[model samples]
Target chain A: MNFALTSFRKDLSRWRQDLMQTAIWFAIPLTVGGLITMLMSGDGAQPHGVLLIADQDESFLSVLIAGAYSAGDIGELISVEKTTVEEGTERVNAGEASGLLIIPAGFGDAFLDAEPVTLTLKTNPAQTILPGIITDVTEIVLDAGFYAHQLFGEEINTIQSLVDESNDAAVAAIAVAIQNKIEVVAPQLFPPVINVEIVGPPATDVQVSLALLYLPGIIMMAVMFSSNGLASDFWVERDHGTLRRLVYSPGQLGSFVIGKALAAAVVIAIIGGLTLVLGFLYHGVSWAKFPSSLVWVALSGVALFSWFAALQMLFSNQNTASVISSMLLFPLLMAGGSFFPLAVLPGWIAAIGRLSPNGFVVDKLTSEITEVGAWIIDVNSWLIVAAAAASGLSICAWRLRSGFAQA
Target chain B: MLKVDELTKNYGDLVAVDQISFEAGKGTVFGLLGPNGAGKSTAINCISGLLRPTSGHASVAGHDVVSDGKAARQNLGVVPQELALYEDLPAIENLRYWGKAYGLRGAELDSRVSEVLDTIGLVDRAKDLPKEFSGGMKRRLNFGCGIVHKPPVILLDEPTVGVDPQSRARLFDMVEAARDAGACVLYTTHYMEEAERLCDSLAIIDNGKLIAKGTVNELRAKLSARDVLQLNGTFPLDETRQAVDTLIERDDLDLEVITQEEECVTLTLSRASQHLPDIFAVISNAGGVVTETILRSPNLETLFLLLTGKELRE
Candidate 1:
């Protein structure tokens, strides 16, 4: 009767009675959250492309033009196999490609006579944002090609006329003539160009990274705050006169405090872990990095549990607990970067983040996943977590001891 | 045994419990009878160690209430007038919670909870919530919660105050059972009848002090020299009653009298009913004839009025 062990046991029993409800509370949120994230992340189904091309004449120039955009980001720009209008419709209907392009036989003759020309492009409506980007790039690339042909065609005509008349250009004269022709003929527009070179594998694998880091870390913090509310089982005891009896019994106050904290930690870890794991499942996030992620998740949970004990003791009742919890939770969640990425916050806000266990845990998760190339294996993050854990435990212990003494 | 010796409490500008003292022996029920604001609850709180006395001391089974509170409390059970129970929890759950708080666990705790539930005759409604219980049922659970640990010293503060007649009787039975189980019971109530029916010994408190303390009969004996005489008859409506009053006005006799519509007269005489024959003879000679005359024995209520100059209920 005197031991807090009784309190812990009772808490466990009550939780067991409501185990199904607890699991549901956890499952519903995680499932909904994961689905929301997926839907919001946009349809990741597959990449579909429409290729458009305008070749003005059936000559070597058209062949060379057809050869230029033959691979990768360039090849995907043109639907070369679907030349006719009917073939284009079939290919698009089959979902094999987005659209097709065609050039008239007289296209090169009109361009040689300096006649105006334009090209057409078709796009897929179902694919929302990316199609526009592909269209704009195709227009600029084609225009540059047209101007280059016009400049080179003039230079070739001038050289043929000079050779038939037997004119001496000199080794120096020939060089001067060719240099004048090249200066007038190269493409005029610099195009404000953006050349993206893929130096290594693109980091499109960010989904799992963000999920592995964020899901566990945030869920851990939330569960810790919640458990503090639940762990104040003493409120129930006081009403029952069980507390009075214990205060008179031979139980150690310290042991009771320890038992309460330990039980809370265990409960939070289990609940938080289950939510995160199931959330990952719903999000279809791979767990190849589970081993590393689990370590940080557990640390975060224990740290949160420690802090919660201190907060919970500051309250005399459930209403007070709720008020204090919000007071702490909002600020902690904000500073800890649970709502937004830390880098986006102002300096002052980031400085506040330095004081939050959430911030420390988030930073640890980020480092493990993103590999921001820390000089150490995240020494600063680990130190912050350790400090937070220590402070929380000490405060909890001090408060509980004083509470007993005063009682 | 529970002993409170010279218990005193002060609340800055007022004295709540002013040097009151009493003892409760094994298998005995001691009542602290007083009107509201008479320091009954303050004294009970001090005895239960819920409040610290300004001076003096209270103990349970040789353990100091303050210094050895845990041990003292181990033997103590308190049933407050307010139903201090969790409404959200079922009756059995509430009982189990209190049982655990008393350090009962696992199978042992379960059995004790069942036993206490049965003691209050609430075994059938054990799984129901206190909120759903009748006023009487809730009162029983309140009692059960306190006695679940089977402490040797039980403090019940007006336990039957708001209960129905049935629950009230059950509560009294439970109190008697606790005493029979060797609990030293300190029962407080403002209802004189409750105290009379349940307490082995009683103390009357007025304005934070013990005005009287003894067994009901012993306290009643304090009024042994006085008698309450009731006379009913057709009086001579006028001069005959005046003559009787004039005859009874002598300083040698101590008497107090009041009349009801002149049809019945009650006389308080500082003598036994043995003198009733002479009293009735005087009335008959005055033509204020008595159809019926009765002299009743003094009781605790008379003793209370004699000592405090006010009724216990008042």
Candidate 2:
């Protein structure tokens, strides 16, 4: 154990001397995460799409269609601007808006009478995601209008004239009739016979920033690069002939393996801490959750470092080991959500990625950072990460004990 | 004290070291001399517990290399053929690390590190990394790292392969000092002069087998009855062969062809000085022109060539 500590100190000093390699390990993740955050953050404080509404109908229903996009959560995502047909067309063509919603002159009457009428939605070709979102929201509004007309066509028609004329008595009579109809139909809409209740915790409106979603993946990338650097030391020592000399020492080989792992863990912890601090300061990461999340990050790094260390032991040539490890690294990063958010991945791919070690640990860290008290309360993620780390270290120890890496 | 009893290491069908046996007592430098690809390193590795012998036993300070590996290693220090010092670390730190590995700690470790630095003549530059030092300084540090614990049995494998004369001289003194202080040193080298100067007893290995073993004079005694005579210049192969045959038949000359090349012919003969005139006349009569004729005394180089039919550095 004493020898292991000595070796660890020596390795730490050596790593410190290699300032460029150490700096690159930390810089890669920060730079990648920063660029991703900048790209995903969009051009404003809030991520919103510009939507132009051309109400050619000039009717109450047309007004309602325009109001639908300007209210609620969808309203936060879209900024609605009323314009003429010529102006809406020009804006969409000029790439000034995500999309233009044109309501035809007979849209209100046709929609109220349950007659088929088309609402033209022209999206800017230059915009992909935001324009698609605008088209989707417009479809929802048209669906809701069709369903309302189908369910209460007569009552809506009776109120339509009253709404247009702006007469007090007529409006009051129409309101009374609508209230009577709603009283008779409200029970059917909800269904007294079969009641649906949401059982989980109430949905909370948590405003997760792009940085929050991307930070964990970036941190995991940093861990991978750091672990790669650390694991490469085994080959470096072998090449330098220090490892061969150390084999003749009275100290157990297991001690050397443990010492190397300990040094790697220390470096990983420092890297994790630095990234987390940066996340907190520049990316709005929760300061209160930093300690727990950093622990997971460091553990993840150790797990990966041990795994690569085992590979280093198994392969005799350093170049072969390095090439294979690097080849494996990129796929792990891609599947582990280092390149992009897992939420954006296909469902099957995301499920597989979440089961991967990096993905699992990153998931735990992200949860810890996004939800207060999550890391402490979450037992399963901790166990999984612990199991991975234990398995990796176990393989490394067994290989080292066999003197497979002493070449 | 170190002892190797019929140490054999085989890699599948290839025998790297075959039943090689030798011993080095306290205060003696035992040299293992061989060309590249010989089993010198394999034997050293087996004795140092770096490799497990296939069919023989090795012990350091009475502890078996395989059975009592840890205890055996405690009594052994190994200077590998390669520079084993960490290039990024200072000489002192490298010594400190190796010292701790040998079970020294605290003040004892620090003092031992200082002593080794002083012994290697690098105390003044102890804080400098190996990369910042000259090749000779690095070689010295590499030697110091192995002996930091002052183990009784030390294995030096070609420690002066590329060292400068001054550093090589300094290392020779250090080795002598270690032996005088009661360390049994097992050294391997391609340089026959180094072996001739430093080793008390020598083992010449070839093709994974020990071909010769004894003190320098004892090995030289094998060739005391004969001397090597060389005739260099353009020589016809048929004429050289005829000359060698004619010399072999002469009653006054006891001569045999050692080697015959396109431009030179070497012969081993008894009483070379007394027979040189007749030997040169035989070559001249066979129409072989000799530009230079040289006679050499018996030495390790000649002994190696006579035994293995090759140079020690081949």
Candidate 3:
């Protein structure tokens, strides 16, 4: 018992001091990475807005126009306010209002005589939704104004003139008449809204495809990139003759190698899990089912650590490890859905994703949150990953014990 | 007992150590004397279990270097020609580490370390980094590190190289104390005078061969020359030198002039105790004035020159 403890303590102290720099090396990058992810999570801003308008035409037709435009909840998004035409155009241009309408003098006389009249309407061209909305509301308001004129017969113009001496009843009537004409030509532009309902219980709220599709590839890439420290540590120890000393220590060669692999596993698990938590906290990923999600992630970390150890040992130098890790990393990233949506990726890439460990882990986690995938969690694939890990450990052990450590 | 039996080592076609052997008993100082590349270092390396021999065997305190490497290593302490102290570490820390390597622990290791530091005359500077030390201090620390574990046999490989005369003298004293502590010491050096002054018995190896091995007097007796001869001088006479050289060079005398310096000349006559009358006859006939005459014994330098036919330093 004393012998084992002494040996373990010696190894722990040496390994800790030797790899202190490497830990800081990895931790700084991971922390900065989490910060950057937190800072850049969503699109620029929310897309909803409001438009306010004012109308001063006080005729009964004008009142009818206001009632028509404010006829439904649609106007809740477009409010009317009292103001002059110039003020209204400035407001519309400044984005405070959507549009402005002005009625000429003698508009009541023209409407009573059944004469033509011109109504000036100013539209804001910069707003894609507001201009169209303003046009639609104007047509509705004018159509109602014309209907009110017809219902009042001769008294419509007289009542409008009494309410506002300069009210443009003819312009309002003509605007509604034009909308009525366009109703024959462009009825679909203002089609009635349809209410939607489902026949059964509703499905989940968040789309599984959105998060699961990219996360697997991201995780895999992260695993490969973050495991650089392990490989770097191997090269560092070899250069420093620390590995030689450890190998010469009695009964420690095997355990030392195992300890290296375990250390890599712990580091990868920590950084990978941190990435997941940051994803949840900042990206708003529903990690309510975090327990099982964390399990697959931990397994992914083990598999990655194993692969990295074997591959690093196989590599002759740091440049070789970096190039190989990245080559395998980015391809898995592209396939497993990190950079772009999986739906847009080529079929072959998605097929490759089917074999990717990251894809498997992410798909497993995503399945608990939303049900949009057909990905199967095959036990055989996991077995294959485990077998790969075993083979890697064996190769690393052999190389470390014999090839480089023959002395 | 430390025995090197007919040990041979080769680096490719070059024979670093030819078949050679020697033995050192406990508490004895066995000096390995040689010129540069005369295989002194190679033989010591084999004895210390650092280099394996191509043939023959070496043992430390009866433990075979090859078959019982750990035990053999445990029995021997080696101070290599190059200082092996870690430069960044303090002297005591270096001593402690080596002590641990030798399986010493706790208060035992601490006491041994302190004792070694005191013996090496570095007790005051034990806490200082070796790199900050003078060449002499570093060499002392190197010696301390090697002997801190108290192995049964200690190998000193050119321990005084690049050291000041004062430090070298102090180090020699320390080595003598090591011998007094009951450890067999195998000392190797090119400085013939050092070996002559300190070695209990000496081995003079040349060209990978042991040319001579014995006490200084015994080895000096191998040449056909008396150990020492008297010289009488008067006013630095050339005739006196010529007369002595002539007598010593004659086949019947078998005597040789060893030194002629500053109004006097010294000679080692072959069978001088028997041929003293003949030497006086020549000195008297040369009209040389005899001021003084005295006889003294020969030392290892004369013996080394006789055996190797070259100066030890050369």
Candidate 4:
């Protein structure tokens, strides 16, 4: 064994002894992944909404239209509440409910008399998807009412007219007329209701894909954090005087850096591998991508650690190095689609994130995680990672040997 | 064997080590004696290849420290003033790490690590981290880490600094053991007793210059058997100078003034115990009262004071 290998073995032993630190580094991103998953309401989650109806008509037609929501599968997503127009308007305006429905005072009579009357829906602008669903249901109800008027307008008008005259005989005669109208139109109006089908179970429900969407970025965040930890170890070595001891040794300081980077790669690959395995099992990542994914992940770890180590060596003061490295980590995590999905982030943020050190790799890993991927794609990514690791670690080694520390 | 010739290091305006030179062969312990800010560390650093000398050069086992750093460093071992062991690692692992660093391998590396653990008396605590060890144990581990590869040339910079008497004794024994193994040891320390007890030959450096160089007895001989004499009382500066003028001029007396204060005066001369009464009579005649009198035989401590006109600890 030579000094480089010696350094590697030493760091490995140190990491083993300080298991809690490694565990925390690995645990943090997973914990963040879980919390963000809950926050984004993934795992087949459905958000419930409130619907307030203000019916001034208090008539049969108006009540029937409002009752339709409670009677259908749409009932699962929305709760129906009856209120006065003033209260309903206040609730919708306050964003306390999804939407408010207002039926005009003469709406029932106008519909029965084959006249036009308005049914107004006031949707909460603050609400996005739920208000739109409510609007769609309302439109369907209106279309059904219009077609019923076209089909049975004469019979309905006779029933309304007969109720005011000699009640028993007129009611019987109107019933027979409605029966005759239904028979005449029955063949042509087979299945009058429009059949709307949901493509899949995701009806306003956030699913596992939403959570998995952030996995690659968050996994990269974990890699960066581990790299940061690895870089700080150099500071410790410098402070403890072991680094000064290395100066007296015959080995090149470059070997020490290479050794430490190797250790970081191992730790990072394990994290990336385990997370990718979970992705493979439940999130549609192919098993065939594992080997390449592992190699890419480990290489990315070395690149990230090397860059962080370069940042550490850039300063003469250890405190400055520490502050700068810590400061660099979170912005990368935030902009790189680790904290929030790139699709949801503002355009400028996503652009900056994609340009960040770790963000491009994150984007590549997540682009088509559900589809089967090549062993590794985009040769430029490999070159970038390789170049970054080489240049950054080379800088660190050069600085270390160039009188940064005196023996 | 290790050799340094005109080794000089400059920090722009400050010369940390200037034109100092010496050589120590196998089985000899050469000591660099100086107080704080004496450039001892700079000189040793240059010799160990940890620092580049501004001009001049050094070599370890015949390899140039500058132009041939790796080869020179391979033959050299450094135990710095600071405890440089990895506190997170067990003592055995620390030994192994440094052993392998010097290019030891396979069975040889294991044997050397085990030997060092036993030699440092950490065999029982081999699996324990340095952080859990006592101050003395950690210091021993520090020493063990340096010599684990058994380099031909070793530099021990203030190895016994801040240690208890027992630990200091253990360190002295370790240095003697390495010397017996035919290693050329270059030890640096300010403690007069350690230099006298452990060093076979040494140099006294101050302000980046070597002031004196010889064996323990040889350097003491520079004092010419002049025992130091001290008198505590009120004495005028001019009167004290006038009082010692006569004896200073006499070659037989071999007298010299070490230091003079308002109420105290120290002087060194041959057989000062025999000349004390006469000295007291002369000071009395000069209107100076000797309230207390003390006399000591010559040693390196006194010689350093004689040569540098300052106390050894100063």
Candidate 5:
């Protein structure tokens, strides 16, 4: 055990000296994860696009439709500008806005009379997500209008006639009629009044951001990169002839293998810790679970590194082993939700992905982030990770004893 | 003391080492001399506990290699033919790691490492990595790693194969110092001169078999009655054979062909000086031209040729 620790220390010192390799390994996952998170996070999280609304109707209903997009949370995503038809078309064609919304002159009358009318939404071809969001929001507003006409057709018709006559006394009479009707029906409209009171201390629940949802996958990717770096060390040591010399010492070969694995675990932990801190600061990952999640991910990384180390023993050359391991790495990343979120995958694919070694760890991490107190008490997940680590280390030890690293 | 008793190692059907046995007491240097593929490494591997012997036993300082591997290995130091020091680590750091591997620790480890750095003559460059050192400096550090723990039984396997003359002389001095410090040294090399100069007793191996074993003078005495005559030049095979046949037909000249190549021929003569005139006439009559002629006295090289019927490097 002392010899193993000594070997571990030396290996770590060597890893520290290789600053360029360490920097490259750490950068790949951080850069990839950051770029992916920035691209996939939708307009719900931030301001998105410019929208030009050409309101030609000049009616109360037209103003109401336009007001739906100009206020509240939705307004933050789209900056709405009222413009003439010619101007709106020019702005959209000039790429000054993501989309143009035009309401025709007869739209209000058609909507009030329950007649079919087309509300034109011209989206820029160059923009994908922002323009698509504009189209979806317009469809939702049209649907709400249809429901409004169905429930209050008579009241809407009274307001329309007052507008047509352009008379103040007629609008006053219509308002009095609506007030009398509401006075009689108010008592029966809601027989039982249900009041909802928020009882808890102002809930600090943070809605999981899209980037946070993908944060676990990115963490797994970082672990994978660390594992690859660790696995390549076997070949490096062998090619340098140090491994064979070590065998001649009083230290057992098993101790050497364990020492190498432990050194890799340390590097993995460093990377996991840094990435989790980034996730907490930028993606709103729960700070309370950061320490435990980092530990879990680092253990998972050790298990993965052990498995790759065993695979490396089967290969004789560094370049061939690295190429094959990278080939395996990408597929594992894709299927394990490192490249794409498992939540977005089809049912069968996600099920398979969840069973992958990396996917299993990713699922546990994401659960710990989202569910309170789950990470602390998840014994089964920890046991699975331990079992994987044991199996991989056992294989590596057996191979080392069998002279797998010999030239 | 180091003892190897009938050590045999086999790889599938190929027997690499065949029942080799030898012993070296403290303060003595034992040499295992053989060409490439002569089971020298296999023998060393078995003795060092890296390989298990098929039908014999090896012990280091009375500790059995297979049954008490850790204790046996603790007392043994091996300098392999390959440069096995870490290139990324400084000389002092590499020595420290190997010293710890040999069970040295604390102040003793530090002191021993410093001593090895001084002994290898790299104390000034102890902080430099092996990659930054010259070939000679790296070889010295490679040797230093082996003796960092001051093991009693040291195995130096072809330690001076590719070193410069100065480094080779330095290694020789270190080996002498180790022997003077009461260490048993087992050195393997194919260089006959090295064996003659440094080894107190030597064993010559070929094709997994030990062909000869004794003190250098005792081994050389095997060829004291004969001399070696080497001729170098272009010679047709038929003409050389005819010349050799004619030379043997003469009653006064007793010669035996040691080796024949396209450009050179070597032969053992009972008395080279008295038979040289007739031997030259036979070669000249058979259309064989000799550009260079070398007459050698009894030595390890001649004994090696006499026993194996081939050159040591063949």
Candidate 6:
């Protein structure tokens, strides 16, 4: 039993016995990732509500107004149901429907005859978004009808007077007249006389699900969590007096630390593997790159753990070590894209994240182990992970031997 | 098997272990007896190569603790004051881990672990985690973990601090067994009975300094086989001291005042039981009323109290 191997087995057994803590370490970030995923998955998150139409007029124009609610994108949000005025009022009063639009009798005739026609829209005060949507859509439909009458009032009036189903000549003439009128307004609507530029965050044409957007960051979050936990075990050994016992042993403390870290690497790698598998199943992480991703995550985790272990060793108090490491943990998580992906972060923050250790892993994991459709292979990622792990563990090993156990 | 020569450890201005020197041969228990914070652990740590002595040197089986730390530690096993057994690790796993840490392996490690478990009387509960064990059981497992590899020198640092009576007896047996196996045991404790029972030699320490060192009988002989006489009654503190002083001066008595208080007076004198009438008369003549009295034979604790002018319990 070499000291390192012995420590590896001991730590692995300790972790097995502390299954609840291990699960908590794995579950916290999974829960966080799940929550963020839910938020992102519900991206349009539109409120659903029915819009009741009491079309007492029953005219073609009145029918057209009611049809607007059930057409296209608006139709997905607000369902349109035809009903009597009394029924519409009852539904709106009960808050079952978002709003009621009442088209009074002769309203269509009043509009065509150039007389004032009032359209009443009553909305449920209980809901905000659905009621607001219904009100906005009703106003747009009314405005469009008003404008059409103003622009082609003569043509519409003449067509109404010609009421003969066999009158193809009149129908053709009215259609031609309406076409000419639309052409007159075509320049204003097509290009818009005044150009309004709407600037926004650069759009990614790729329809990245929220889970995919956050998986890399969340994976790093899990690694950080695992690292912090593993780092604290150094204190556990110290507090339990095993460290002092080790000081009396022939085995080198450095080898012991490395062995324990190797065990932590296995635990973290399992976490990474399970999360990566999750990505493959639902978040579109490329299954082909899973093996390499697992290795990279393990390396990144040990590297981070080594640093935390070193930092924890510097402090005289275990609570101080825990508090300081935790303080450092959250910032790293935030800047490294654990809270949000670098692709979605602000330019400056994302820049910092891209240069950060976790951020580097997240970014590299994304570019190299993307969805099957956008996957690319870069072999050099292993070097970065390995180099970081080597440097960090080297520092940790030196720190442990220098005075930690002896102290 | 274990030797410490003028080993001193300093925490900046504080001398934690000040020039403490002692040696324990194979098959013998060398006790470091001191109350809490008396540098017992520090001296053991220095010898065990756990702490670097600021001055002087110590060796385990001829290996210098500082220069040949690994070799020195290779011959050492430490049972710290706190239960060092991992709470999550089962008793057997704890034994095997420490056994392996001492460089034991394969069949040797397994055989030794079982032997140590049997010696500690925990073989039946080998797979049980220490956290689930009774206080005594955990203490036994703690001891088991230390001697699993059977190092030549064993350092037990107050292993019986919080142990129950049953566990204390079990631990005594284990220490004796290790000593009988020809290992030099460095046992540090504050309990006088344990020192008298287990240690072949004792080093009485106080405030990081070795006040006295010798075999238990030799140290007690230093007390002149005196009996400590304690009288419980109303006695003027100054008069009581003066009376004892006058009596010692007049009779040329082998008596020394250990303590003098208003309600009690304590003196260590030769044949205190025989001199009880004289002592009572002296106290009465000094305006003191003796209501009750106690006589204790000379022991290591009496010697410690006499040498340090401070109670061993302190």
The better candidate by DockQ, 1 or 6, is: 6
Candidate 1 stretches greater than 4 Å from native? A19-32, A39-71, A74-106, A113-135, A146-208, A231-245, A248-252, A279-320, A341-351, A365-407, B84-118, B122-138, B222-314
Go through the candidates in order and give each one's DockQ.
0.24, 0.72, 0.07, 0.62, 0.68, 0.65
The best candidate by lDDT is 5
Better of 4 and 5 by lDDT: 5
TM-score of chain B of each: 0.81, 0.92, 0.80, 0.95, 0.90, 0.93
- What DockQ does candidate 5 score? 0.68
DockQ leaderboard ranking? 2, 5, 6, 4, 1, 3
Q: For every model shown, what is its TM-score relative to the native structure?
A: 0.71, 0.81, 0.53, 0.84, 0.85, 0.84
User: With candidate 3 superimposed using the best TM-score fit, by how many Å does residue A330's alpha carbon deviate from the native?
Assistant: 13
Please list the residue runs of candidate 4 whose C-alpha ends up more than 4 Å from where it truly belongs after superposition.
Answer: A42-152, A158-208, A278-284, A368-371, A374-376, B232-234, B249-252, B261-264, B284-294
Candidate 1, residue B282: lDDT:
71
Clashing pairs in 3: A53-A81, A54-A81, A142-A176
lDDT of each: 0.68, 0.85, 0.67, 0.85, 0.86, 0.85
Q: Please give, as one word, the docking class of candidate 2.
A: medium
lDDT per residue for candidate 5 within A260-287, as digits (tens), equals 8889889999988888898878866567
TM-score, structure 2 vs. true? 0.81
Q: Spell out the clash pairs found in candidate 6.
A: none
Per-residue lDDT of A1-407 in model 2, one digit per residue for the tens? Answer: 77778778888899899888878999999999888878887767766789998888999889989999988898888999999889999989998999999999998898887678888899999989888888888889878887777767887887776764767887777678778877988988766676678696534233477656888899899999999879988888878888788788875677787788888989999988898898777766546677788788887788889888887778878888999999988998999888976767899998889888787777677677666443552777677667777788788768755776456
lDDT of 6 by residue, B4-106 (tens): 8988999999999999899989999999999889999888877877677899999999899899888888888888888787899988999998888878889
Candidate 5 wrong stretches, greater than 4 Å: A42-173, A176-205, B232-265, B285-292
- Model 1 lDDT tens row, A94-200: 76565444555665556555677654556666665445655665566677667665656665445434644766653346567667877665455334478897696
C-alpha DockQ for predicted model 6: 0.65
Candidate 2 error regions (>4 Å): A42-206, A281-288, A372-374, A377-384, A401-403, B232-257, B260-264, B270-274, B287-294
**Candidate 3: docking tier:** incorrect
Task: lDDT for model 6, please.
Answer: 0.85
lDDT of 6 at A129: 89
